[model samples]
Target: MARELTTLVTGGKFYEGPRWHDGQWWVSDFYRRSVFTVTTDGVETHQFDVDEQPSGMGWLPDGSLVVVSMKDRHLVRRAPDGTVGHYADLSSVAGGHVNDMVVDDRGRVYVGNFGFDLMGGAPMGPADLARVDPDGTITVVAEGLHFPNGSVITPDGSTLIVAETTGAGFVAFTITDDGSLVDRRVWASMGDVPDTTDVMEALGSGLPAPDGCTLDAEGHIWFADAVGARVARVAPGGEIVESVPMPDGLGAFACQLGGEDGRTLLICAAPDFFEHSRSVADEAVLLTMQVDVPHAGRP
Candidate 1:
């Protein structure tokens, strides 16, 4: 069945990193070079800007905001008083341009990367998951991931599940006390990993192509399918319990389950994604739908 979607915001160059916090939906407009918060009724207030373009967003235990500066490979920090500064320099450790991230209660951040020159259409390669300490130290948590994109942490902060786009599965890892990721295993395998270096070829090879994800109270994960144009509710071990197709066949890039009751699923949709085209167009939108289960775990 088609899930009803209500538009909360429109006219974006390209929307990514849909997050819910403090009674509003926060998202990054990749081409607009800015982040904004929107209420359920479509009211929007601009937050801050990132010249290099922003992708992922998370908050620290102190309530300060962290934004990913994709092109420059840096993490930008915004304090409660609205001051923005450099949080961490990831260029040296990140395998490629940084993408999405999830921060634990202790301010330990686990970040993903493109692993290749995605916008330039460079040959696809594996990437690394980096852990940025609260004190600004960088460490490679895991290496050789096939384009690790969206990620989430268990409620206890002991386990992490990351969506590997090219790998066609969700990868799991053990989070150590020192913030290192170990015990690498496949949480869910949708299909065999393709050997092609081309992104399109890998995505078209009958795989899930999972991207941004959110965890629910039942421990099921709702992940956006970048190539399938839908949001899939996946149980552990590769079971796709449900899939909510995007309205008008739009592509669902990222989703967050947040609201007063933590059941509102906000989805970021676009006609398509290509840095060159999205940078010059405004076809992205924010859509919302209520779900049965409330959200659980860290984003």
Candidate 2:
């Protein structure tokens, strides 16, 4: 049995990027273009606007914040002076808006995107993966994906597993020293869940493809299953082991384990869509749960 986390934030249009920083979990509100910091007791210190669709966020070695603006197709770095600068332009390789991402231990950033006009009616090419090295050079790692959304790197930095949100599965790839991918294989499949289409399927029925994720000390992946409204823990063998529950019964977008103790499961959840237009219930929210396992990063 799993514990159902209560709502930490309600009536949010959309939420993504649950990251631990500055003594709080800083998250991006995708549809609202705002960033929020939530304390442990569910008190939000602030919700500041960033003026762009920020999907993912990272921290530089020097203590600056790096943000991924999807529609802008730019990697932004929030300087020590709190000014945002364009760190890299990824529009050439990314067909459309960038989505979720994972920054590896060595400072390489792997970005995923909505390649073919997923919900915006502005169709593009097949989905692709972009890699930005420490020198700010952008490289295309993989392409022809259905919908590359959430991702996480292995603890050892030798593997990066990405979620193909629309294709109904996840792909594990071998990460090269230069931040390229080879030996790509299906790490996990959605296993034919109902109400899920082949492409970026609808949510709210507990069946949409996965979106955001993080790992535990045991190397188990706790991925946000969009429509499922649950953060499912996937074992190293790629099996769904323990599922942490949600409040809205909607899409649990992305998740990460962070905090001083590194045992808190922070989740970004929102309502789902069918064909990107039809909506079920507005169950969008942010939730958290205390788990027994420590986070992979801290381990």
Candidate 3:
């Protein structure tokens, strides 16, 4: 079925980590260094600010908020009274700027990083995924990942799927009781990741850099392709069942399924990822489209 895309919010600088929780759409503006929530009609309220910039976010069973402090590579926790404090430090575990994260039902967090100075033009390298326990202990769960970005834990809490952006696939890991990731394997194969040095040449190859994603009731994942300017709904076997392209010149960086029945695909769109351009310009916008399947997984 054809879906209609609408702009739900605008005037942000590089939005990421769109999540549906407690009856609202929460997201982080990377360059703006703030996290906020928006309503279906476009009303928005500021949540909190992160000095090092904010990315992924989730809540604990006790109703506290956990947000990723990207530059500093730390998890900041927000209490019920709105006091924000350091939850866990990743500087020792993360080798570069931390990107996205997913928290399980038990408040265990899985984090990803750039592995190299991406914006500084350093050559891409392998990164490791870290697990942060609720009690603030950190462990490297998986390694040799090629730019692991958005991730999601299965509804049953037995498996974790991470988007390997530069690897052109999604990798799955078995989660154990001790919060360790094992049995690593490729869950989906999209295409070959470009090996060219030119950024545009790599992106123009049509091979997608899969970013933030959300799982649906049918166990299908809808993920944003950073370079393709589109969001694709892919089955477990890597078949793209649906692809929704953004308008001309705009790129989709992340997405989430939420709103009422959990069928709304909230997309984060922007023109570029360069820090200077995005931080100085208000080009980021939150768009929404209605899908057929409702969301059915952990945040």
Candidate 4:
């Protein structure tokens, strides 16, 4: 099947998270320090200066906007009254920055941090993942993960599947009653990575790094590649069933399946390597295409 790219909100800043909310798509442009809303027609990008690099996004039961402040190492909640409050100070647990997150229906946010700084071009990450409680308490849910990036929960909320970005794979954990991970194991491994990047030029090697991911109603896991420029759909058995080719042939960062019917696939891409330029999406847009299934685990 073929998919078409539609530009929704271009030429403002670096856009990352694209989430469907309140009848429109809300996204964060990290470099520009703004949050925006784009109509489904891919036109009219409105900016909200957030004063921080907001990456991932989610909503609370009370309809507050939960944004990840990467530079400040904090999770911020934007209340309906227009006040932004600190939900969690992740600096004590986050080694680098708070990148992306997945919030369950119960309002629990699971966030990931950069284990090591890669902007200097090095394979130094094995970032850890942490859970932020509703009461704003933070705890390390799992450790020794190689750059846990985008994540999703099962339809029943029984398991949390996470993408190991720098590690080139994914893992799953049984969520206990208390919100801790149990029975941790690799959900998927892309393959072994070799040293070749600029970081490898310094530290001597590179990693494949699967970045962001989502799931389908049938339990298929879909992931975006950092350098691969492809989105892969994997079956529950940990086998890749189909691969969606990205046209740009560059770093495709993240993706989510959304639409009125939940069949339109949305892609968030950086025109080039993000670490080097630290730029935003001028055409960082919302690309759409109809699919055969609806998104699973909170799109």
Candidate 5:
């Protein structure tokens, strides 16, 4: 079914890590080096600045905010009183720039990285997924993942599904009682992905490069097809049940389902993912569309 998307806001420099929290839509603007919260009617307010560039975000049980500082490979915590401080540093374990993350109900944070110097044109390689306990202890839970970008924990908090951008599918891991990941398996296989390190070649292999995503109540995942210029809803067996195309010349990069009823699908889009171009232009935007199934599970 075709759904119309409304432009919620504009003039961003590559928005990522979109989330719905505390009755507002929060997102990180890469080149802008700041995080902003937007109202349903498109009013934007700068929440905080991350000098190293911010990516993912989540909240603790006490209402404190944890944000991923990309370049420095650190997690910054913002207390309810507005004081910001370092929560944990992953530089010692992260192979590259740490990116998106998901903080579970227990305040355990699971984050991923680039695994290589992506912007520097280095060869693509596997990276590890790190888990940060509530006490701020970091551990490499899983290793050798193909660029884990966005992730989601099941409503029961028993499973974690992560988007493997270059792997062309979603990988699932059983979350143990102590916040460990086990029973690794493929949740969705998009296509026969080529075993190549070239980003363009991997993207052009006719497989969906799933980026940031959110899970719906019906057990379907809505992910941004990074190079496909659309957001696609995938079933467990790798079936694309629905897809929403982006506006002309733009590509959807990340998405989240939120709003009063959790039916609102917020999308982050830009002309391309090139850092050079996006860092210099304000072509990024936030788009919204209403869907039938409401969101379920963690961010």
Candidate 6:
């Protein structure tokens, strides 16, 4: 069945890292360099700001907010009291800009990065997934990922799955007791990996480039198909069970399953993803659609 989408909010530069927490929809605006929360009825509020670009977000057990500072490669923490500080730095470990992350129940954050200078037109390269402990110790848990983007952990916190935007599929790993990722395997293979590392060439390959995503109760991953202009729900074996195409002229870049009943699928839609275009144009909007499966697992 086709799902109809409704506009939730507009006039944002670019939205990413969306999550449902504390009864509100929280998201990061990369070009706006700020984080905002939207109510179920579309009331938008500025939560805070990141001097550099902000991507993914998650909350700690103590109620502090952890956000990925993309440009500077740091995890910025905002305490419940509104005090902000640096939690961890990935400058020395991250190959390029740190992108998205997922925080486990123990507050261990798994983060990924771009393996090359994306905006500068450098060829794409493999990146590493790093785990940040509660004490701020950073360890490279997995390596050789092609543009690792959004990620999620199972409800039991025993497995981690990440989207390899350039690799054309999803990758999974078993999470050991100490938060180490092992048993690397392909969770879903959308298509063959592109031969070229050039961003444009890879995007033109017609493969499903999974971006920010969320897990549904039935263990299906709802991911934004970056170049497909749609958000697709895929089962574990790479079957595209369902898809929702973006409205005309808009491209889907990220999505999250959230709502009072966890049935609302929030999509981040924009005209294009070029930094020069998106950073200057406020053409991005957040759209929502109703889904049958409620959200599950750690974002």
In terms of lDDT, the best-performing candidate is 5
Per-model TM-score on C-alpha atoms:
0.98, 0.86, 0.97, 0.90, 0.99, 0.99
Q: Which residue runs does candidate 5 get wrong by more than 4 Å?
A: none
Clashes of each: 0, 2, 0, 10, 0, 0
Task: Give me the overall lDDT of model 4.
Answer: 0.74
**Poorest 10 consecutive residues by lDDT, candidate 5:** 197-206
Q: How do the residues 174-285 of candidate 4 rate in per-residue lDDT, one tens digit apiece?
A: 9888899999998886666554334344222333456667789988877777766667787764577777766663456777777787777777766655643656235454
> Candidate 6 on 178-246: residue-level lDDT in tens?
999889999999888768878889988989999999999999999999999999999997999998889
Between candidates 2 and 3, the one scoring higher on TM-score is 3
Which is better, 1 or 3, measured by TM-score? 1
> What lDDT would each prediction earn against the true structure?
0.90, 0.74, 0.89, 0.74, 0.95, 0.94
Q: With candidate 2 superimposed using the best TM-score fit, by how many Å does residue 233's alpha carbon deviate from the native?
A: 1.2
Model 1 / residue 288 / CA error / Å: 0.5
**TM-score of candidate 4 to 2 decimals:** 0.90
Candidate 5, 233-290: lDDT as tens digits? 9999799999899999999999999999999999999999999999999999999999
Which regions of candidate 6 deviate over 4 angstroms?
Answer: none
lDDT tens string, model 3, 165-230?
888779999999888888999888898777764444655677878899989888888999998889
- Cα displacement (Å) at residue 270, model 6: 0.6
Better of 3 and 5 by TM-score: 5
